[model samples]
Target: MSAPFRDEEFESAWRELDEPQLEGGWQLFTEAMGVTIYRRYDEETGLYEYKVLGVLTSCAPARCADVYMDLEYRKGWDKYAKELYEKDFSGRSAIYWEVKYPFPLSNRDYVYVRERRDLEVDGRKIWVILARSSPETPWDEKKGVVRVTDYRQSVAMESNGACGTKVSMNYFDNPGGLIPSWLVNWAAQTGVPAFLTDMQKACDAYGDYQLRK
Candidate 1:
């Protein structure tokens, strides 16, 4: 069970973010906390894919990238995470995450692979992390939880030059179940911004956390 994505795939995703015409099909969904979210209808899944762009006023790009990759630190900040861990799949490591939904809804879990890249395009530094759901995992589905089968997310970050980081993210997923469309859309519009705010808080405290470690 090697990684399903290649380095070229991540590079291509990052390049797409840099393209000026990439926003053509996406419609503005919401704006909050310096982030603007856009959504586009996915014909294949009848779901919406989100594109988020913002400037995080909390930390530098490098620090922000480091915070994102630190699983131990994530456990403390991400309140919605019920179960999160990583295990080796063949020679590659993959993540297992179970997210807590509202009381009446069943929790959703995901098995995914992620990779991070540090790149410099024309002297501007960029940090990119790409993740996608994988079917090759040793875990089995739990009775009380629903497994998310089609999930993909990519984030690109660079310095904003005022001690902040500029971030661009593309996210899509289908939480398998009979959830209403409006509820799904509402969650994306709100949850994504809240997650960014939490991430900034985590980034702001990462230095202290590392010192203690």
Candidate 2:
């Protein structure tokens, strides 16, 4: 049988996070139950990207954000973005927060980065695609899990400057497991929003702060 999971190790990762990341900008840390995404954004992309560093716990319950930028400032997101909201968002639990915003992307600029996907609860699938003017690397290319699931979907978005924003959407559902069905179901439905909202606030604050100064 598998050994019981421990949270102590995960907690240590947060403590080890560099405090220098929080200088000059704002830092917000919120928790639901089992997940916590630390974020930092500053005047420099290096520091803004570095602030929200690493995936602490790699499981179905994790998500992270990096940086990327839009190349054309004049080009709007009207074509790329259709609608932004959460379908399965749970209002009763308050675990999921829906974030909707139309952020303009600067013309010919790559000022933001994206995070690697980490988490696999069941046959769930994780994916990341960067909207760049030029071809680079696929953001979702990582280890752990593959094969996108049938009944799963979630999208996350953020803008860090005048142009360019990154949106990451993942869909998955963990069914038929040893763990309590309710617990698994709850997390499967709620994890995406909880993680995405934290990222939104961090990026928004950091972006605005950087622009002001």
Predicted model with the maximum lDDT: 1
What candidate 2 gets wrong by more than 4 Å, as runs, is 1-168, 173-177, 207-213
Q: Can you write out model 1's per-residue Cα lDDT over 110-161, one digit (the tens) per residue?
A: 9988888899889988899999888767778899999997899988888877
Per-candidate alpha-carbon RMSD to the true structure? 1.7, 20.4
Lowest-lDDT window of 10 residues in candidate 1? 15-24
Q: What is candidate 2's lDDT per residue for 1-213, written digit by digit as tens?
A: 112223432222223322322444535433333333333443432222212222323212222233212212102222322222111212211011111222331111111122223323253332332211111212221232221111222333333222333333322222211334454334433443454444444444444444764
Worst 10 residues of 2 by lDDT: 89-98
lDDT of each: 0.85, 0.28
Candidate 1 residue 82 C-alpha distance from true site, Å: 0.7
Question: Distance from true position, residue 112, model 1, in Å?
Answer: 0.5
